[model samples]
Target: MHLSEQEPSSWPQWLSVYHKRALLGGGLLLATALLWPTPQLTTGQRIALPLDLSSTSTHFSVPDTLEALADKPAFSTTITTGDTLSKLFERAGVDQQTMYKVLEADLNILALDTLQPGNEISFYLDENHQLMRLEIDFSLARQVVFTQVDGSYDVEEIQKKGQWQPKAVSGDIYGSFYTSASKAGLTAGQIQRIETILKEKINFARDLQAGASFSVALSEQYIEGVASGDSQLLAIHINNRGKQIDAYQFSDGQYYDANGESLVRAFLRTPLAKTYRLTSNYNGKRRHPVTGRIAPHNGTDFSTPIGTQVIAPGDGVVTLVTDHRYAGKYIVIDHGNQYVTRYLHLSKTMVRKGQRVTRGQPIALTGNTGRTTGPHLHYEFHINGRPVNAMTAKIPMASRLNKAELKRFKSMVSQRNIQMGV
Candidate 1:
């Protein structure tokens, strides 16, 4: 969506665009003046050279805006470890107001927030030192550019269906699955994802014996021969003794076995292993006791001790870990596939932002940190960006693919199997 900036505030942004081009348009006058091949004259000197517009062999052309931009001081920065948007903008000499403006413009998109340590961002400023354009390169395959339009910013999201280069890594279990996978050129994150996906099928520590082998068929995205950040597992084959196990990732972002059965990895129904008393249920129609308003209870309240352990219900990336005035210390986790989980009124957080967590992993301790009557854990589950009842709502669970999808999956598997030399 394109937002219009207030007419009054639009001057600074469009100044860089219209004014610069206007200055270039003035270059025609200079070009016309250069037609006189006589000796160089000062400002007071007037050379009466008869210029015929009909047959002047010299061509007059205005300079491009890029040529004008060459004279402006350029701003660029690469996101690094421990770098925040504010910190990077500060380093680039941008004020807080401008940063907020950029963020406000990107409220509906997933650009600014998804930037990692390796991503790149640059700012283009006008003569008044105002941000005219901002470009964020997530990878070689994707980019987001914000241009100053009128008074607001225009957002452009660029995505490329990059070429997927299949890679097969096979090796015998050495010391551990992690070590062997690392030796076979798989990243730690990749190995962890595979373990999480096949967790229900095999216990890497206990199931594998001597002479066990593992084969991973994955694909890495690349654009113009440059690798992008889209490595994903496609199919895996593990042979332990006489038992053979295999799983394939279908197009629906779920894994299944050779028989089209789901390698189902569902979130734990509850974050706590040991059940505590349920103090409150998800009541969307409940009224606030103090505020005397129809403030719906969107989360589940579990009455627990101050130091009760809280575990992650699903595999996800920690998106937020902080304190709130009314909610206390809370942690928000983003599980992919439009699933998210939130834990509020926490005493301690075990994971930080950007950290990957698996199902049943300890993530925090329950406590009353916010506006609460007592110590308890408030949990919320979200699907498609809205809070739902954690106690009843269906979490991410894929049982099996449909007939048409299964046919497509078979074709994908056949192609991948040949690629991996299975």
Candidate 2:
């Protein structure tokens, strides 16, 4: 008998064998897929899962490590023209005590008080919803952070000297300097600063004439190809009736002419008429007389009788006149060009906030108001918010540059002039 005739009944058994092998292979594949472990997501990695909108129970969840950050409380706001630090803190739900602590930390740096329009500030809260960190972005290149350390806050500033792109604008004095400068793309603030810099030499309201030419040299700061809106005034020039007045910025941050003569009035080195005995000098590691611990004495102390007149060291606007537990009654004068003077331990403050005082004007009276042993005066000179030894640190008494300094300044001025297209 042939094999084709004999296999007719055995066809079902052969077919069963093929079916069983197919089923076994399918089972192995399904088992392997179901038994495999899912790889975990690394730090900063995220998983995006498609959602079925029609389903009710289906949901997405973040990793456990990221939950804390996602749940943490945070607040941020941009400072406006009338924005204040206290009000901003209140909106962030921070208590006044914490705000005061931040202010106290700002005593040395004074960064918080200098908040300007368009600056951003943020506060981060911990698990307990208490402020843990605060950040202020002053500009694209400047940032300040305050972090809670123990019972106080530690301040750290991150600043970058970004590339500055030079800019120049020139115009004819049509009506007023302010109008002409504004037409030439100078801001109101910039115009005001220029007027202030050249106030001693040229009076824009009185000396500037119509049809006279004026030019400004400024720099627009850039960070990573982004405009920071920070315009630096490099130089200013005005030609009126054939008389030329120039003010060029120098490395010392003061403005001067090509001859290295200061553009502003001189600062009075001794604010008082008569000399007083020096009781304590500025010491970074001085032992505190009250606490008996290592503390930094940021200002010089002079022993004077009560009611001794305290005069302003320079022409400036009084920014603060307030009382403090440790500092007592103090007056802060903000002299133009990054200079500041403080009179502390005063029994009385003669000037009010926002009052402009002359170089020799009375500002306060010395006394033992604070935690001091006797009647004395605590005077401090600050440059860019950091206190220096006024007794030894270089004071700007309308400084006339020396030979070497003048040469360097003239060279710098020439370069700036070319950049300004003058």
TM-score for predicted model 2 compared with the true structure: 0.72
**TM-score between model 1 and native:** 0.60
lDDT of 2: 0.72
Taking the tens digit of each residue's C-alpha lDDT, what string does model 1 give over 1-422?
11111111223455456555666779675344434232211000011222233543423233344344333323566677888877666544556666765664553243566678878776655444566677777889877877665545656667777799878888888678888889988897688778767877998888788778888898898988888867878888888877888888877667899878887667898999898999888886665554344536778889999999999998888988876556778888877545788898899999999797888999999998966889999988877556789988866675877898888888987877776676
- Model number with the top lDDT: 2
Q: For residues 40-109, could you state the per-residue lDDT of candidate 2 as single tens digits?
A: 1110101122323353432332223323332332456677777777766665556777777677655445
- What stretches of model 1 exceed 4 Å from their correct place? 1-67, 70-73, 81-84, 106-115, 149-156, 266-314, 317-396, 401-415
TM-score of each: 0.60, 0.72
In angstroms, the error of model 1 at 213 is 1.3
- Cα displacement (Å) at residue 345, model 1: 12
Error in Å for residue 363 of model 1: 6.6
